[model samples]
Each structure stands twice: as structure tokens, then as C-alpha cells.
Target: MSAADAELRQAFAQLQAQMVETQQRVSALEPQMAGLQRAQLHADATLQQLALAGAGGGGGGGGAENRAYQPVGRAFLLQPLPELKAAAADRRSNADAKLEALKTMKDYLERTLKNSENNLREMVQQRKEQASS
Candidate 1:
């Protein structure tokens, strides 16, 4: 093989490896992304329900003694409604940030995969031309 052909082949192999790794990572993230989306939605729904309950009561003698329970490992902890609300809000924010980060990573991986594929195609074309010469 010509020196140029050898160089192109080596580069193509390396690019192929990188593309495979990127694809694997993207696959791994898909499930986590889906789970995070569900969590975000659940948190948002909980907050909305809480808001509705508080506002719709309109002085239904409920006082400020609202309460809730949050999971703590294998158990549940009783907390005042305000604390639960805060925790739910925090979960929502955290889920949002995580989802955004995962999306950015996926986007970057996709770009890398596209570039690698393009480079491989160009290399193949060059190698073919070299062989024909």
C-alpha cells in the first residue's frame, strides 16, 4: 500500500473506534435521560397539586398545619408542607439541570459521530483515488 493509503487507513481505524465509543455513551445516556424527564414531570405535578390544594381551600380551617411525607432511603419522614414543597422544588431544579447536561453531552457526541463519518468517507474516496492512480 502507498504511504498515503497507510496513513489514511490508520486514521480511519482510529476514527471508527472513537465513533463506536461515542455511540455507546449516547446509548447509555438515553435511559437515564428518560428517567430524569419522568422525575421532573412528577415533581412539577406534585407542586401544582400542592398549590391547588392551598389556594382552593380559601380559609377552610386548614390553618398553617399542613404536613407531608418524604422518602428517606427505605423509610419515610414526616415533614411540614412547606419543607416538602421546598424539597420538591429542589428535585425539579436538579432534574432540569441534569437533563440539560445530558442533552448537551448527547448533542456533542452526535456531532462527533457525524464528523468522524464524514472524515471516514473522505478517506475512503482518497484511498480509492490513490489505488486508481
Candidate 2:
């Protein structure tokens, strides 16, 4: 009986540790999710600006086509409106993909945490029942 109780205690401690680890992982992903969301929004705005520029340049003879001043590593380059739009779209898609992956990971971790808690509770209940008997 004592050995069984000791085993149960050890299991409970392990479950608690697992829950804590899952919680930490979920917490760490939150900031990354926020940053990705912000980047996506920025990309969206850039795309919108590019669209407006393209539209305005279309109605008038503005050097044949519109161009966007995009920043490079340490300099600005005049890029075609189409190229800028494509780049912005790519950024948005990448951010969205990363955000989705992080969200899925966080969800899985949360589920694991809940399962651990449930297992811990069940163990305690069983221990109580055994003691009562």
C-alpha cells in the first residue's frame, strides 16, 4: 500500500511538471504570434498603397507604369508596382503561415496541459477512494 502511494505521488509530480512545461511553451508562442500578426498587417497596408499607386498611374501617362520605392539592405530601390505588390503579398502569406503554425502548436500544448491536469485529478480521486476503502 505504501509503495502504491509512493508511485501515485511520483506520477502526480510528473504530471504537474508536464503541465508547467506545456504552459511555458504556450506562453512563449504568444509573443511570436503577436509579432507575426503585426507583420501581416504591415504587409496588408503596403499592398494597399501599391494598389492605389498602380491605379493612379494607370489613368495618366506616368512613365508607362507605376513604381514603388522599396528599401533594400541599406538603400532604397525603385521597384515596379507589380514587383512591390508581389513582395507584399509574399510577406503577408509567410506571416499568416507562421501565425497559423504557432496557433496550432499553442492549441496542442494547451490540450496536453489539460490532459495532464485531468490525469492528475483522476489519480488524486483514485487515491482518495483507496484510502476510504
Candidate 3:
């Protein structure tokens, strides 16, 4: 094969490898993303419930001393402990980092894949021109 063909083939192989790696990274992140979404949803629901309870009681004696709002088993408390809040913040930061990494990988793979396609098209055009001449 000509030098152009060789270069094009090498690029395709590298692109394929990058695609595979990116796919695996995305697959690994899927579960973590789902879990984070679920946790955020639960926290939002708990906050909404607290808001509704407050609205119903009009900030009276029943508002602050809600026995029903006692958090249990992953229930996000409106006033979480300081340590617990710190830990949760750390978890959120980690999740955000992973999500950003996944997005970067996806973008890189997309650009590289497009480059491979363009390179192959150019190689084919070159071959056609050579044949015609």
C-alpha cells in the first residue's frame, strides 16, 4: 500500500482503540450516574415534604417539632449533621469529577472518530485521482 494508505489505516486502528476505551469508561460511569440521580431525587423529595409540612402548620408549634420528619435509612435530613454534610459534599464532588471525565472522553472520541472518517475519505479520493491519471 502507498504511504497515504498506510497512514490512513494506522489512524483508523488508533481511533478504534480510543473508541473502545471510551465506551468502557462510559459504561462504568452509567451505574454511578444513576445512583447519584436517585440520591438527588430523594433529597429533593424530602425537602419538598418538609416544605409542605411547614406550609400546612403556618410555623406554629407543629412546624419545628415534627416527629414524622425523623430521618432514617438514607433519608436526607433537612438539617444533616456537619460531618455528614461534609461527607456528602465530598461524594458529590467525586461524582461531578467522574461525570466531567466521562464527558471529556466522549467529546474526544467523537472528534477522533470524525477525523478518522475524514482521513479515510481523503485517502479514497487520492486513490481515485491516481487511478484516473
Cα TM-score per model: 0.86, 0.90, 0.49
Tens digit of per-residue lDDT, candidate 2, span 66-86: 777999999999988888898
Which model, 2 or 3, shows the larger TM-score? 2
Candidate 3 error regions (>4 Å): 1-8, 57-62, 67-113, 120-133
* 123: Cα error in model 3, Å: 4.8
Reference-based lDDT, residue 82, model 1: 74
Off by over 4 Å in 1: 56-63
lDDT of 3 by residue, 41-89 (tens): 5555655665665557544465545434345588845552333334455
* Order of quality (TM-score): 2, 1, 3
Error of 1 at 111 (Å): 0.6
lDDT against true structure, model 1: 0.85
Best candidate, TM-score = 2
Ranking by lDDT: 2, 1, 3
TM-score computed on alpha carbons, candidate 1: 0.86
lDDT by residue (6-30, candidate 1, tens digit) is: 7876898898999899899999999
Q: Which should have the higher lDDT, number 2 or number 3?
A: 2
lDDT of each: 0.85, 0.88, 0.61
